[model samples]
Target: MVDLLRKSEAFISQLSLVAIVDDQIVGYILFSKIYIVDDQGNRTPSIALAPVAVLPQFQKQGIGTQLIERGLSDARVLNFKSAVVLGHPTYYPKFGFVKAEKWSIKAPFDVPSEAFMAIELVENTLQGIAGTVEYPKEFQEVS
Candidate 1:
């Protein structure tokens, strides 16, 4: 999350969400632009949700949910077509996430199919836009 804050471009700033209490940050979520490149070399605009975090002491209290809601809501407003995530299968499905593979979309890395998920922001956006996901360059530095 910090790497995205420090290195990702301005568009990420528009969709990143935070939760605060008494001026202390309790949680954060980021939705950054990614691309889906097809065989013909066309690219579809997409977003990636990742690095959602809440202090260990704050987990299970809904702060993370609030962060995700805020982030994805803003992403829709920003006109992103779809969003992808590599997260717990059960946890993310509650937020409308589903296996990206279902749409024929694949993650850049080989992860468990259930854990690699995506959600459409605009109806039908992912209907035929399937390909490998491409994350921003700075994501390589995130770990």
Candidate 2:
């Protein structure tokens, strides 16, 4: 989280959000600009949700879910076509997320097909798109 904050210039700042609790920042979620390349080599703009966190004491109070909802909603208002997340398959589905493989989208790194998910902000936005996601350098640093 420190690295992401240190590098939050340019695009990341526009997509990051914090969840406040009693004047304290109890949770955070960030979305970064990403692209999905089609077989014909066309790149489509999208967003990637990563590192959503709520303090351990705040867990199970729906704070994390609120953060995700707000972030994704902000992404849509910013005109993002879709948003992707490499998280729990079952947990993310409640937010209308489905397997990225169903839309031919691929994750940047190796992970189980089920754990990778995507939600279309606009209908048919992901149609025919298939390629690896490109994350920011900060993500690779934590890997």
Candidate 3:
């Protein structure tokens, strides 16, 4: 997964938050940049929350939530205007994700409407944003 992420141009940035248990890596989460086409077909910047993984023994311990919250906070601090995620509908709203379709934004592939989500880091950043979420080619090869 790391190799595939490293090879993608759309991977503008990436971060890994780790949880150590007994001095061993027990959890990790990654965030990567993604692009979306606007009405005129020009690319707009955004980030994607993907491939968050925790060792089976660590599941349900709030490690994933902490990683996501910290990652989003970092994105905001770095001036990222917005973020999108394809994930469990029930899980993302706690981080402020709403249905992207509400803003006319669609994922490149078919997914449950509730599973495709987005959030604005700054107020009104997504005001005029609309269109398709295009993930990096590396995602396609491995997805």
Candidate 4:
């Protein structure tokens, strides 16, 4: 993950939000650059929430929620239009992610429709956006 981030440094922007307990990192979430190609083949800028990890001991705490909520809020402030995530279907909805298929959005790789999700950070941000979600090329290497 770190290597991908390093290689994507040129085109990707990342927000690493950490949950610290007693001054030690206990949970982390990474939001990185992503895009959806239009019918015209133009790329619409977007973001993807990936590689979220919480220490085993921290699981089931609200740390993950805090990390996602805070990161999404910050992304909204930064004018990010939307975010895509491949994650647990049951867990991500709490953060406003719905099935990406609802928006005619899909991932480059085959995934369960329920496990791949998206959220519009700004009102009507995705009104006209529809296409396959493309992550940084670096992702394909690790994925």
Candidate 5:
């Protein structure tokens, strides 16, 4: 999946971040372009946070947290309106992600509501946005 996303046309290198310690990568996170499409077929651009990981030796440290924080900040600077993540219910909220359902957003696949979350980069960016998140074909290729 990582390779596919990186190679896909939709991949934006600027949105991929890594944590390096002593010249070795200790953590990584990728925020890729996605969309929120309403029932009427209106599409709202967004991002998807995926493949966030820290090396086993680096787990429980703050490396993962740093990666997430920095990545989201960069996304906001890039003018991304929002972001979604299918991640741990407890872990992601520290970054302000709420259940996407709060805005009537849904995931394309079955996932616990708590595990699928979204956040607005700009205040109220998702106020009127609602729909299933449309991930890139690279995701489907891996599934």
Candidate 6:
């Protein structure tokens, strides 16, 4: 998935981040551009936090949490309105993610509501936003 995004989404590189220790990559996270398409076909821009990973040796060491915190901080600096993620219902909430359904936002595929979450980078950025998230074609290819 990272390879696919690298090949197709130019800006993805800017949002792609990694954790390094002892001159080795230990973790990674990517924040890719996605959209929320409303009934009238209006597409509101957003980010998708996906494909986050930490080497087995790095697990339980806070590397994933650091990656997520840094990624979200970068996205906010980029002026992104919000971000969506299909992740642990318990884990993501630590970073302020709540069920997308709270704002009428949804995933393109069926997912447990608690697992599909969204976070507002800018205060109230998603207040009135409502639609189904449209991930890039690369995601479809993998799925």
Candidate 6 per-residue lDDT, tens place, 1-143, comes to 77888887624676899999999999999988999999889999998998899999889999999999999988888888899999999999999999999999999999999999999999998888899998988888886
All-Cα superposition RMSD per candidate: 1.6, 2.0, 1.6, 1.7, 0.9, 1.1
**lDDT at residue 44 of model 2 (Cα atoms):** 81
Query: Which has the higher lDDT value, candidate number 1 or candidate number 4?
Result: 4
Q: How many Å off is the CA of 5 in candidate 3?
A: 1.0
For candidate 5, write residues 72-108 as lDDT tens digits. Answer: 9999889998999999999999999999999999999
Full-model lDDT for every candidate: 0.84, 0.81, 0.84, 0.86, 0.93, 0.91
Model 6 segments more than 4 A misplaced: none
Q: Distance from true position, residue 118, model 4, in Å?
A: 0.5
Per-residue lDDT for 1-143 in model 4, tens only?
64667567523344778899999999988888888986788788898897799999989999999999999999988889899999999999998999998889989888999999999999788887899877887776775
Task: Give the worst 10-residue stretch by lDDT in candidate 3.
Answer: 7-16
Point out the worst 10-residue segment of candidate 1 by lDDT: 1-10
Cα lDDT of candidate 2 equals 0.81
RMSD of 1: 1.6
Clashing pairs in 4: none
Candidate 1 vs candidate 5: the TM-score winner is: 5
lDDT per residue as tens, model 2, 42-126:
7788878887889999989999988888787777888888989999877999999999999888887789999999999989988
Residue-level lDDT of model 1, residues 4-61, one tens digit each, is: 5456562477776788888999888877778988878788888888779899989999
Q: Who wins the TM-score comparison?
A: 5
What's the TM-score of every candidate structure?
0.92, 0.88, 0.92, 0.92, 0.97, 0.96
Q: Give candidate 4's error at residue 130 in angstroms.
A: 1.0
Candidate 1 Cα deviation (angstroms), residue 9: 3.3
